[model samples]
Target chain A: MSQIDEQLRTELQRQGVWVTSMQDLYNWGRKNSIWPLQFGLACCAIEMIATAASRYDIARFGGEVFRPSPRQADLMIVAGTVTKKMAPQIVRLFNQMADPKYVIAMGACAISGGPFKQGYNVLKGIDRYIPVDVYIPGCPPRPEALLHAFMELQRKIDEQKLTGADKAEFLKPDQPSEFPVPRFGRHDLEPRANPNVFQPPVLER
Target chain B: MSATIETLEAMERPPVSMASRLQGELLEVSMGPQHPSTHGVFRMNVALEGEIVRKLKPVFGYLHRNHEKIGENTSYLGSMPYTDRLDYFCSMTNNWAYALSVEKLAGIEVPERAEYLRVILAELTRLQNHASLLGFLLSDMGAWGTPLMYAFREREKILDLFESLAGSRMMCDYMRFGGCRVDPSDEWLAQAKQIAERFPKFLDEFEDLILGNEIVIGRTQNVGKLSAELAVNAGITGPMLRACGVNYDIRKVDGYGFYPRFKFRIPLGEHGDTYDRLMMRALEMRESVQILKQAFAQVQPGPVMNPKAKIRAFRPPVGEAYGHIEAPKGELGFYLISDGSPNPYRYRVRPPSFINLTILEDMCLGHTVADVMVILGSVDIVMGEVDR
Candidate 1:
């Protein structure tokens, strides 16, 4: 897509690294088996559970196994408000996991602290301590939104061809930050002009 | 008198031994605070003499976050989503209880259509929860994911219906105090109607798969048996009470919402054991399906939300009330104190999981460790509700 990206790809290929054109492979793998650690703190955790149940069916995307130990997990889907008291435990969990870990800030509270940002006990943003791959922006995102975030994460992972080195990029302290809050609804705090529904108008055939 | 009492004590202590003095050689072991099947982060210090439990003392507060304190700070509207966090399994029931309480305090009237919609959603929520919970119980029994997958398939349909109406599937936050936040379009209603029609077939399929299985029956029946008197004393309601042969469904006795309008039989089981609990839930799901059918037929197209109620920065008058719903687990009640402000003065959740847990030791005293999990599973304690 870009000249530098092409050059990088060719350079990597020249170095005897196998280049697979199936760009969605990473996404496919991530999508099928999202082994989440069973770590929940507050209200948002219920939403996380709801996501796992019959209706949202997180199992469809292959994240059904809610492992208790941090070592057995692939994605750390942080589901509730992270308090200062619990910060070290979270850091420890993050540290314990094997390489190629992805963190999904599952609710508004986790993403820039949501409504609890003003509170003294709440952490400002989880990114302050650990790097976040995706931010699901909602007071508490529904299971569907979480599934969407997972799909999006898969796409990003596949497109980048994120191997060990790309994972290392995130490990560096001075690396550029890319915590874009995934947009699912209107950005405006106020209700939009089309209050009847949130869909763009369908044009006539 | 003191000398006589000492003489009597000396007369009674003829065959004393160190082993008998040490609590009949009962083995004391802690089962939880980390065990998988206690539901939440709950610890039970159990003293057992072989397979029979001598005593059990429950240890809680590990998952406590002072939910009431947080509710005091959140506004009436803000607390709606917070309610969804409780009983994370059946969020609709949680939302309804909160809305009902606030509405009662504010004296806001919900429209008939809205009431019908609420009933339909609540019943659907009940059906989905029971199905998923049964699967969870089976998993606890070592059946693993087969049943859970089946339950999830049906649950997906219900959630899709919720998604079509509300923007979110699980934490719907769809029900407001006066009425619903959004109306179901014709398409959504049709989907619900379809689900209602086909649900029985799915249940039939489920029955074929697991209900009649000899293994399930042997594992569940006559295990963790509780008498009707004990169940009532424990304040258990819904399917648990029904399992104990009490016909007291809150929907029947304390008629609220559109439950009064619907005609359905409350199913009761003879034994209040794990098997009966499962059977009661299964039957309750059938009843919910019927209620859905009736609700769908009677539902009239109109405004879902009450047009007259001004909900902007919702503020309720100063009052206190307890609102309870016959949730899938049991009676989920919300106790709210509003001091003429947007936010509640004090809010407490009568969490069914926490309340039903009062009799865990009673249920597990004579049962094996494996049966303890099965019984806990039948109680259907969601950690969110238990912890909150």
Candidate 2:
């Protein structure tokens, strides 16, 4: 609608030529249309739902489409307490997500296991297994806090370069795209590639 | 525990090849730890014969963060926030339950004003919780977020009040051992009184929207009936028990706090079906409004906390105490063992959600798989409490 845009379009149409960086277009598309998995783990999940509700609608940021299936989603908002029982499933869900996916560690629990950090069952943070794009801090962050994390994630996404190993990580066909899903065994088994964790018997039999 | 259709097929192929009798066998399905309908991180291993459920096994601990273990290791005051996460929707009642246990352990008496404040907040919590339940129950039945949004609208007002009072909406660790953390200013009281007065109009609107729906009635009525005797045997308490026509309410039985001073009725249901469970909550919200009105009016000038109550390094006598209260869900109790130390020797929470869910398989015995959600929703198990 602007004068320069009309001229550029006409000129580009006439010449059948356009100029733009690959990374800019890719990041622009990814940043604006993040689809969060329709997943919630604990107390912070309530706030996450509140954000999805009418008051602080995440749709404004194009993050409201909560895909029940992880395969369809691009963002995983690790919303609440990740216990040992849930850690494997969380890893599986993350691995099932398609290439070019992002994860936002949403609260104190997902960031550092929160007040439950002292507990035996809690994982210290989710990033020990999966890469995190953003970390929002609060016992359970407010809806606004989550929105700020969204901004932070968007900013991080915008900073990528279409060169170097990072570029190959996103663009290459042969690059690895999955992590070994943790499994239940004698003690909980970590994903094969990740270091094994020691289970401390915190309570007496 | 959700497996994609692809994964489900992959799962079925191996088992189906081994068994030739498909006509007489039950299909096993795992629903949730990450479902939209389990309320929170809860999973049910359901075996189905056609549409009817043959067996139900709820596999929990997915949300277990060891609340009691951490509480036992921390200072008395440090555990308040952890309690909020257990039954996250009913944080006020959770706070009061733990505070009551500590108060009992220390033999510390709460002031009149604080008792009145606790009653107000607890009742408000009940109103919001039941409202939320109704919203979610209807959603589980396949109506859209219209009812839930309206419920959230009412709940958001209460959350705003909580935010003003305790600095956080959902996790309000507002209650202390002998009293509340902050006394209500006159302005706060006036606003709360206004909300309490206006809440009935919202309830009337909610009742109008939900009570007459044919879909709700047909789906819920006589769907998941639990007999009174069986429910009692299962140790099922709270609204689930009341729905079976049991007259037991901890407020009336134990007479904790100033419950006896306040005049209110316990809403009981005739049949222990999902419909009755739903009605019990709506009816109880009316009763909560009654208590709130009385509590707000009767609150007088007094110290919020007893003068002798200390904040830190609180040492109780070497003994144990079990303090129970009629939380919105059911009988919420805290069992604490003190060794005359700053930290409790042992801390155990008698979570109502966890106990109420004990009857899930019993209730789901003959019902269709669809009704399982209704029964579980009716039970209202927050996994934070269940797994903790």
Candidate 3:
């Protein structure tokens, strides 16, 4: 089959005739209806509520159905500080989520532990355990910032290939859906960071 | 219900060989750590016989980031922003409580204009907190997001005021030791006054929607009853204590800040049940509006910060001081002991949510598992403060 010219494609679209690949249709449906898990951890969770609420209505982007169960949710917004004690439970929740799930580390705390990084109980970052798709940075990022990150996630989803070596990770059967849940050791969480998920660059002074 | 209570009591204090007379096995259920309605990361270990909750134990420290430990490690000025994360809802009040403690320790005097500004901000914080609490309580009762959306619609206006003046919507670290960080413009004050003027209408609209609803009344009226004696004995404060018909608001008792200058009545409730607790917040929001009106009227042009008070390298005297304020939730107090150093020798927060949760089991006894959610919502335990 010959590739359709841009002018011809435009003419077809104007006439209500649409041309789209299966990958485009799949990504379009997935991106538009990204249902977030109804979970809140700390201060940033309040801002997350604000984003979901009336004024910042996350429903505008079709990402408003905040499912209470991980099985029904497509997005896991780790929306606040992840403490050492709660890290295992968070990881467990993530593992319970179905394939084609994405994680949004929704605050500085979720991204790099924020200001509470110095605290003994605070996990340095949630990315230490599970793979995070989007990282929004702020003490507690405003609702507007959260929406921006959501759009960024959508854009990333839009670019995913259907059939190729670099196809979406969720499409790969060998890709692990679950990560290791850390345990509470004497001083810190056992296996401080997941070797597979986290790779911090070496710093030389 | 009386028979159920009797059976619950009998189960609590089993008589000799009563185990043989007792019915089926009690099922132990842990309700949280990731529940939709536990508020935030709070866990309740509940033992149930059918639908009624027989035994309840609240598990804590899930969201704990060692707040006090962090406060102790950081400098006096450095800990201010962290206070915003404590209650999360009433950051202004948390900042005031901590600042009040540090000022008491250092013996710094807050200016008149600054005091007025603090009053205005605190009352605004109160209004938003109560509105959202009611919304959350209703949502837990299965009203879901309609009421919460209504609450947030009003909350966004107040947050706009905060974002304009204090620089952040939720995390407003605007209070310094002796005064506020920035002075609000006359335009800001006018906008706040307009919001205050319009708040009662929202309350009226909210009441029309929820107050007389059969479902709300049925679910909340007799559920989670707390006796006046138990409330006082368990060290309950804020709206929870007032819900028990106690007239012990710290704003009136301690006369901290400009509260004594303003004329506002403390709303009291009878029956001390979930409905009373819910109504207490509604009534208190009305009182807070009155306070805001007065503070806005009396506020004059002057320095927002006290010139004598130091921000960086702030070291209070070598003595301990405990200062408390009537935060939206309850009596939020901060205790600090300075060692003539930048960081305090000891820093402790007497979080209202944590202390208020002490009587969780007592209130939850004999109630249904669903009622437990409503009761916990009435308690309003923000996990950041509860676990911190």
lDDT of 2 by residue, B1-388 (tens): 2323343343445445413444446688899987878998899887678899866777878988888888988899999888888889999999999999999999999998999999999999999999988988888888867788888888888998999999998999999999999877888988999998999999999889887889999999998899999888877888889999999999999888899998999889999999999999999999999999998889997899888999878888999999999888888999999999999999999988888887787789789998999888888878888888
The TM-scores, one per candidate, come to 0.76, 0.90, 0.96
DockQ score of each predicted structure, in the order shown: 0.13, 0.62, 0.86
Better-scoring candidate (TM-score), 1 or 3: 3
Q: Rank the candidates by TM-score, best first.
A: 3, 2, 1
Model 3: DockQ against the native? Answer: 0.86
Off by over 4 Å in 3: A1-5, B1-22
Candidate 2: Cα lDDT at A95: 90
Candidate 2 overall Cα lDDT vs. reference?
0.85
Q: On lDDT, who's better, 2 or 3? A: 3
Alpha-carbon deviation at B24 in model 1, angstroms: 7.1
How many angstroms is residue B10 displaced in model 3 relative to the true structure, after the best TM-score fit? Answer: 15
| Stretches of candidate 1 exceeding 4 Å from the true structure | A1-76, A79-105, A109-135, A138-205, B1-57, B313-315
- Best-fitting candidate, scored by DockQ: 3
